[model samples]
Target chain A: MNEVLLPGVGLRYEFDTAEGNRIGIVARRDGRFEVVDYDRRDPDRSRLLLRLTEEEADAVAEILGAPRIAERFADLTREVPGLSAGQVEVAADSRYVDRPLGETRARTRTGASIVAIVRGEAVIASPSPVEVLRAKDVLVVIGTPDGIAGVDRIIHAP
Target chain B: MHTSVALLLELGLILTALSALGALARRFALTPVPLYLLAGLALGEGGIAPVPAADEFVEIGAAIGVVLLLLTLGLEFSLGEFAASARRHVRSAVVDLVLNATPGAVVGWLVGLSPLGVLALAGATWVSSSGIIARLLTDLGRLGNRETPAVLSVLVLEDFAMAAYLPLLTVLAAGGSWWQAGLGVLLAVGAVAVAFVASRRWGHQIGRLLSHPEPEQLMLRVLGTTLVVAGLAELVGASAAVGAFLVGLTLTGVVADRARAVLAPLRDLFAATFFLAIGFAVDVRALLPLLPAAIALAAVTAGTKVLTGAYAASLDGVGRWGRLRAGTALIPRGEFSIVILGLAAVADPTLGALVTAYVLVLAITGPVLARLVRAPLPARSGPNVRVDRR
Candidate 1:
């Protein structure tokens, strides 16, 4: 996903779907999002505005397999090859605490993926490798049964 | 002498009843303005049972509501942005002035109102309700349209016009002499100018001063300053709401944001009361005589607004359908229209019934028309098909 500030207009978040439809979600200053679908051929077709609120946009994003919720589910299914999906809470004593996801060899060694980092009510979906994992962070991981066990052991390792 | 207990009870009853009516309005996807007006009419001076205990308090509440309404409206707009927009779209402003404001003035003349009444009526019709239009735009999903900027520019012009027009109306209603009215206008402009400069320069500082760490303190300070300024403006024979609006414009950035969060609930409460108070001021029987004229004026103004919008959008090079969308979107007049009439009605009671009738008809009609106009065009004529992925 690519986001751009439109200056006076709003924030435009543009992305291409798997089906190759170019979509843009323009979040206006007034907390409204205009979901514009760019038609490949017609300028008029691309000009339509399907407006939504933040919550509505979030729900739509989930349905579209994008944003926080859907991205996590997709990451889990993709990384695990359809085996195990579980939330492993990062205990205060865990070695992964205060470590960036890139520094953790959980993915390269264990073949497991951290789909999302849930801290309290806020969920950071599809966190980049540079994203630091904190204590008490609930990591939504995906892998085969052995890969899942490996992620737990590697994180909890003293 | 009314007992405090009786006053409290009456206030409670009125509010509860109003809440129920508000719920009913929301259920039907309509504005509560009409409902509030109807409730006011039913409980006012000539209604079935006039409210005796809390009448005075309701009146005070209504006044505060108007102040808050104008304040919040001012807060939403920045003078810098308004100046830029005004410069960019002078033609739209002129067209809007001619198409929208003229009808109310003409209607006033036809009805044999005094000069003040004509001005009052003109102000009432000149501005479409920003609150209503913003909601309609979002609901109809037209916020992303190319013509939306054009539509918004027209609205901004209307608001700026109202800031000046309100004081003129206030001076007129105060029965000032010609020279006095001239002076009033000058002072009004001066006040706005000074506020604009001050806000642009020192708005953040003022906002910081008002924006206390505690929400309670911040709310009190903001409310206190607004009331004081409003009172002073009233003392000088200008619109009090204008003063409050200036105060609002002076507080920008973080303070403005905090003010909105702190004052919105209070604004909503009093604003609702103001609408209800408008209804209460009206005599139900008088509404019957004005219904025909109100409907006629609404029909005329609706056309004029559409014309204004379409022309504005056309100037922006938007296509015919987009022009139509722009026109239809500007039809509904809500808060500001009511505020104008509310001020005028204080001097001339007859105007209340007329305005209430007019606002009600358009409030319902505007959204429906906007919705209908934006419906898909013919299959081949335009690419109106929306691609929604499941």
Candidate 2:
């Protein structure tokens, strides 16, 4: 990826795809985004494909990205016979609420890994040990069915 | 409390007229600066209507307008952007200065203006309107063009140059000796360097000091601090605009963004008043006499700006059409040129008429010419292209 600084405007990021097509995205200062394709005739000139407002861009990103994340983990779990993936919700009354993720020790106790935490509209992939767990967080766990169930019990335990 | 009914009525009417003119300008996809100036001319001493009661308010508002303009301009920048631009486009900036400034100097010499007038004119011609051109690029959807970075870099450097240029002009305009002017320049440049260092090292602290959760408090803190610093700069022979710019430079990240949002409306109001004040200062009769010279100067400088823009864009390896787009994009002269004239108008009274006419001609024409440049080939409808939204 090539990042170009448009001073007093915003940043332009350009990258070439495997298909040999060059694409550019201009992220403007005012939370606007412009997606463009470089003209084959004139490599410098960009043909604007889409203009997205901040909210629209976020929506588009989520639509394209949210499913792939879960699918990848499912595919990984499918590779092993006994492995499975499950979401363990962090309930409001859970002891870990507003506390660091490390304190749970779910991975050490049940051999299940917390791959990501979904909070509201955002996904925190590969959250660090110090990441604070909040109420209603959906933790994506990967392990055997028994391990996944054990991890869920540990998270919601009184 | 006593309120002047005449002042309220005239001020309200003037604002309404400005809004109408602004809408007209927007309909044509043009900056409202020239229209504001025209309105000011019409409402000034020798025009169709005069607002005697609002005169004092307009004058004071204009001063605040310049400060706010510079402050916001400073806020728009970051040290990283400035360094990257300066590193890459130092040569382009040099070419831009030489190509654009020489014509103005030659014209000033031909007109037999004093030394200060020549310097001021040179600066007026050298700088492009970042405000107008940035908006133009966005409006035309040319922000993704290959040459945009080159164009924007040149603008960044020019605005940075003004930090030094303004103080020198201020000292000279005040009839200071060469020694004093030199000292003022050094002091201003040093201040800029210190501002950059401060922003890098203690930006968070400064941001914490100024930023507030409440928009009203943020507005008050930023405005109050900027005005106080501007006054101090004026006291020390540096330009108040430069001082406000320094205040802007010290802020970064979220603080600058929120401050900008809160201050934007106030800046617009005052900036409109500033443009109007320039028009009010110059007699319409004087502008008519200077129109021919202004047109001639505009024609020459506009060409030079094209050359400068092309040179800058060529360095970025943009194609011929892209270079042309870049060149035409740099043609408009607006707020800063008028600010330069405002600083030096006292030195040469005729400068007001000449610059106002020059800016009026170019500000209107520059954007139109830029748009006329071959429109980007319509988005190719193919597997890769998708119209996500209107």
Candidate 3:
């Protein structure tokens, strides 16, 4: 990895993957991060991959670091009979989009508990009743298979 | 407790006008610095409207603005980065100083300015606006470019140079003799060295002393310490700005980061007021007469900045177009130039008008030129290739 100092801006770290692609990450002073790939044609210039805010960077770190989190839950579910952990994605067209998590009444209607909510790179563990559910959120539902199916039905219902 | 309604009304109106101007500048991808100066001109004597009531406040605010500016500048300093840049770009910095400062010095001599005025003008032209250029690079998505480190290193070295240069200028501006000015420079340089050593050795202890969990407490601690230090610096003729910068340099790690976050808004407000005060101090009539000279000086110095940038980029082995981009990127002269002028404005009355006009021209045109350089040459093909010039 090549670490470059940008002075008043921030530090930039660049490295080449085994695949021969050079990746650069510019960590700004204002808690913003920019990821870019070196253009093959112009080794000096880079193509911007994405810009991430501090929170988004944190969420990205979490996602990349905690890939085994769900698998751990899956292992726990294996010990019980007829119990499973399922992820229910909140589609854009879901009726409960932008509504509070309580509005889904997943626990009351389906006897399933939402263990967590994953929005983008962020995971909200043990989300409160007032936690708003946005489009494309994946709710980690823990319950029997039928109950998990029932919660999904309630979330997607018109 | 008597309050002046006129002061309140005038200040409110001025801030509103500044905000409107700032928005307009941002819309066009320009810095609001020149606009703020224009507003200051209008608000100054014999322009359009004069705010006598707010004059005292602006004056004091302007002083604080310089302190805050240097303080934050110091806060941004990292010993590691400075060492790296200095090692790589010492030649570039020397080239930058020579190529750029010469025009302003020559123009100053031609215009028959005092020896001190010549020195100040030279500095005003030499130091590119790091604030404006940094933002420009980010906005134009050139941070990831090959020549960027070269550009940034030059800026860092220039800012570090100011720590030494400012004290010398301050002593001279204060009507001190050459020996006194030389001593002041030595004193300031020694102080800077001491600051670096102290920051490295006792940084955490110093950080702990100033660090407070509450934002308000932290702000108070840092600002109070900086102001006191700045005042003492001014007393010794080292210049308050340098003192504030030293204070900034001493802080490191989390304390510096939090201090920066808390003080940013205050710095912005005061820094804008400082710019306004520079405009207010100058006579608009004087400014018009100096426009031609300012333009000519801008033209010469702008070319020099490009040459300096190209040379620096070349050191990094960047090809022709990339070098051009680097050179043009370093063109804009902003706050620091104004700060230099503000320091020496008293030496020559016309100095204010000339520097203001010069900064206004380059500050507006520099970014535009950099952007223009990018339009014709897309980064992929022509000049992005590394050329080993050994």
Candidate 4:
């Protein structure tokens, strides 16, 4: 089912759950969107996903070089261009900057790793896979959304 | 109308109120259980139509209700969650039991009941309504927070304790001897073990059935599952509510959640009836003379749980006041307490009126006590507000 994007007139994009659910906050050019998308399983944890309608120069800088590459395939199974739309969305999961490299690595595929760690005011180019995660390491990685979700899981597990 | 139709009407009155109250209470920012008991009070001798005129039949039915309630509760816990925090949960459980039981036992005696009965009362009230609180918290958007996990961990332990406590109470209520008590404890420990093992073995199959239901047969399948499982729980000397809880517990994974969503109509239907029956079935005037006793008992019960819960919260290392709020949140004596009193009256004839009064007063005023003592849980934490989303 879909909701009308406008109050009157009609611009509506019916949701497609088969594409996998997009939930949680959608921080965007407009006010953030908190949509309760369907999960085939538990519906209690309504996910919120955002879209950036505005791309001014500073906003473009925050867009991180390229759009995400994660959303293309229904599922991420093998090595593919990390620049795929789906992958780009995966990287863009967080608008926030501070994160742990280890945690980011953990969220992605166990096979996949973050080759570079970037965060506020500083950057770690080609950080080793074994590097212990510090609190403020902004992560750039190659892996599936599940893997990223896993990494998010580990960081918050304790 | 035919007798069957009349019975249906009676049943509908009870259950509809149960669902509607839950929905309404949540809508109004009040808890559902008290609304249930108030429904009970209103439906009792004084209110409108009295269904729970005596606790005997309803007592047995309530046993079944508890089983169903637990079924829902068990669904909420996960092995992954358990595995992650086992050690901390153990520490938390130990701290909570001690803190909660001391006052529970003492106050039970001070109120002129057996220490065992008081201890039972304490145990029943010790655990807060996680489902109630969790739903409220989720609605309020405070469900996922840094501190919330810590709080949830505590609740899981308390829930586990409550699960175990009901079985032990059942055995004792059924006249198990002291020696049997030891054996009963051992058996309950075994039950948990059995629940885990069974879940491991049949969990997948249960989940699968939940997912692939025939459209015409879906209703039958869901109803059968609650009844058969709850019946089995009683056969094994556990409450049916706890049994339903176990069923929900075992059927984890994506499918369980799917089943839960589909089974919503049934759960809410039965659960609402269950609450409404609790309200309408009671005899209010018979309980009126016991007002002095109930008030004293309520004061003592609330005082004990709050004080003890505060102590438990303190161990979490929050400040004096925050701990106090946590303690206060634990105060409301809801369904289980009412069920226990009803069960006790069945087990012992002389005590029915007094116990009913005890549950009545506690149920009505408990929420007021909760608000007075606890801080409002913070508003929902926006995911964007996170410092790190890794």
Candidate 5:
């Protein structure tokens, strides 16, 4: 990421993701952030524009970047001796992809509850059962090692 | 002694009533200014029961209110921001001055006011309520809109203009010989210019004096300094509010924000009293006579304010709806108008009633119009709209 100071305006941070998505975040002096997403096909044409408070921007960044949540939830890991918290990628082969959380029943069968689901740059924490999981959804689950493995099987089932 | 006790009881009851009204206004999402004014009117000479004892105290409180209002306004812009915004948006500021101020002056003239009264009316009409405008923008989620910067720049310019206009009006309204008034004006101009230079040179050092972390200490220091300076300005025949404003400009950096946090509630309390005192001075009977003229003047000035915003936004290449939104958002006039009229309250008989009626009309309409003129489509918009959606 490259950050440029636009004098008299604000600070603009621009970067390209490994997936070839272009993003630019402008942090205004008034403590607001403007996030601009460009279509990979046409870098000049913006696909989405968003204004966010600092907190919202931080939340979104945590979802997109996996290491952020690990650092943020380090205390939780330390509080539980045997328990672990990790994110699982819902790839193309995942059977529960595009299905609602209630229908998957991963919590009921494996004793591993999905605490959050991160899709793209959006974070849905303490999600309701009706929330539909989609491809590229990253599920943040908490359980014992055995439970996590069981739920991982449930999601990855083809 | 009996009258003194009566005054104490009356003041206590009036304050309690005003607090209730303030709550009600908040519940209705309305600015409590008109309500406060109405309460003042109801308690004044022509109302059901007049406040004889507490009127003097209320008058002093109202003066403090004006100083605090101007001071907080000054705190919002540092000298650098003020100077930069003025330079960049000089065109809009000029347009605003010409368009918004003329209607009041013309109306003042039509009503056969003295030259000073006309000047007071112009000052009343010229500036928009920064407090109201800022609140409405936040409420309507338009702070990130394309036209917001245009709106903000005009507001800053008006404040900058006030640095000059306020002194001019104060001197003229002080009621002295022509030479004395002229000298006062020159002296005021010199004082403001000196303050500006001092702010540029030693604003940081001044800022350090106000940087106490303890809220109580901070409040005491800030308010004490403001009142002393304000009193000195009034002693010199310039408006105390102008001195308070210059003090605000001088305290830059973190201290300005901290002072704002500490001083806001006091400002609100005193400012509400200021509005109430204006209402208190007004004869209810006089209001009916001036109602028509006030409405007519409000209608004209509203159009002109909109034009000022639209023209400036258009120059900035904002879209049609954005321009309209800019114009309508500029409508609400609040504290500043009342502060100006508050100074003129004693000088002219009909000035209070006329200004009260005029400001009430626009202050109510301004926020409603701002909410109404929002553009539905955010196409080709400025950089920030996504966060507002959530």
Candidate 6:
């Protein structure tokens, strides 16, 4: 969250959930981040555009309860793989998870995978770890809503 | 009389008036070209300022605008990608064009017009405006179906004709020898053929070159190649954009699915400018006296085009709904008609005026007619193809 590409240019970091793939990302302005990678799989497929920002990403991540899914995109590859921005729901199945709050959601959560993170009209491309899970992220988790709620408390708890 | 401020003011006034009228037409679901044309007529002869010599500028300017649109459109004509399209659509496209254009031409001749004018009209209206009809069909989630092929083929044929016939008319009117016309047509075919041959012969080398290059450099080469090829076509009397289109068509087969994305932004910018230019500095007065004729002609253009579409589509198991949709799809006319008219106008001013009047109707009423024709959409090319996937 505290990274700067250049002077006075405090760039935020993020990844989007696009076509079910994790991608690296950097944001130059508020509310729009450049997709850097989709889970370290391929870089040539760059220029993945997304509409969510770090703050909005935080809100969405918290709401979805799969903050770690943002970082651990590799887990969702088979089910809800990452992609660039613009897909709403990937239609992957998921089960609920009940877990205690711990390190980053990536370090803690198990079993539950995020199928997608649908916000307003667009999907977050390929989200990544180290990217803050926002309350706005409507994480389309594989598990039930309660499982998502438990996972939410794990990463987002102060 | 030659007040400078008055001119700018008039321009703004016309755009605003036409825009407002267009909005109203949309609200009422009436065609807007008639409204735009009416606005031109009222302001031209009936109002404070007249749109003098609209006929002259719109003639060529409209053609260029359509060229821009066609240039954008050429990307869609990629044969390879559509190879994966449904068999139903392919059959439909063939049946649709032969059925529609052939009869449509005869009927146009039956109406009061010269042979060349009738030929141009038949050619212009034969295939539905693929751009318009395809878009509406896509919106309705019917672009990939049994009838989709017929609709798309007619649309594809008409679009290609727009670029080709436009220049053909120009060559004829310019008094170029039939030899030159024959030569120009030959060159056009050759250019398109060469692109395929070259791409087949060396497409991989180009793709490899693109794989590791800076995004900027890759884009530069693409643009450079497109321009160079298109320019060559213009040098030999073929449409330059048509050449670029062929290059695109050639590359589509070689490049696979990435070609469309590569050209998306470039096409979008050029397309926007092209459409906006259609609304550019057009005079209103010259059209004043021709208003009645223009109106009548617009009706003829739309009626004939719709009938052709309906007839062509009907032969392909395109049910009543498909036929109706085809009819409405053919409603919009823009660049191709303008091209034919502009070229013909050179041989005879009367033919030119008639074509111009007709295309104007197509451009304006195209959207409205689409809106009015509310039959259930035809099926898509594949069951997996999402509605509005385009």
Error of 2 at B326 (Å): 0.9
- Tens-place lDDT per residue, model 3, A44-122, is 7766767789889868865885445677779989999888998888875576766899988889888999999988558
A-chain TM-score in candidate 6? 0.28
* The candidate that achieves the highest DockQ relative to the unseen native structure: 2
Clashing pairs in 2: none
lDDT of 6 by residue, B1-390 (tens): 765565466555655765687578646544454454445434432345555434343334444444444444554554442432333344544444555445436554655555666666656555444444544553453322233445555555545444455456445555676677776776766665676666667754554454322445645665666677766766767766576667565553223234444556655444433333333323344344554665665676566556666665666656665676666666776555544443454444444444445556666677667656654334323223222222
TM-score (chain A only) for the predictions, listed in order: 0.49, 0.56, 0.64, 0.34, 0.60, 0.28
TM-score of each: 0.75, 0.86, 0.82, 0.62, 0.72, 0.53
lDDT of 5 by residue, B1-390 (tens): 345887789889988999999888766566888889889888886998787888898988888889999888877765565666666679988889888889899999999998888888988888998777866765565544556667877887787777777766777677666677667667766876787787778875686666565789999999999999989988888779888987887776557767887899999888887888888889999999999999999999899999998987787677777788889888888788888887776768788889999888988888888777743543553454443311
Tens-digit lDDT track for model 4 on B50-134? Answer: 6533334454555556555666567666765665445544665676666655555565566566535775656644655565544
Candidate 3 achieves a global lDDT of 0.90
Better by DockQ, candidate 6 or 3: 3
The TM-score of candidate 4's chain A against the true chain A comes to: 0.34
Residues B245-337, candidate 3: write the lDDT tens digits. Answer: 999999987789899999999998999999999999899998999999999999999899999999999999987878999999999999999
Q: What docking tier does model 2 reach? A: acceptable
Candidate 6 residue runs with Cα over 4 Å from true position: A1-158, B1-67, B81-119, B144-146, B160-167, B207-220, B253-307, B311-315, B342-352, B364-367, B370-390
Stretches of candidate 1 off by over 4 Å are A1-24, A30-32, A38-158, B1-3, B375-390
Q: Of models 2 and 6, which has the larger DockQ?
A: 2
B141: Cα error in model 4, Å: 4.4
Candidate 4 wrongly placed segments (more than 4 Å): A1-67, A70-158, B1-5, B8-24, B45-48, B51-64, B83-86, B89-91, B110-116, B139-141, B144-147, B213-226, B279-282, B301-304, B307-321, B349-390
Model 6 interface CAPRI class: incorrect
lDDT of 1 by residue, B1-390 (tens): 856998898899998998998888766656777788888888997798688988888889999999999998877777656876677678988998888889888988888777888887887787898888876765555555567777888888788877778888888788887788778888988998899899988875686678776789989999999999999999998889899988988887657767887999999899988998888888888888989998999999999999999898888787777788889989988889889987877767657777788898998888888877743633344435353311
For residue B228, give model 6's deviation from the true position in Å. Answer: 2.6
In TM-score terms, candidate 1 sits at 0.75
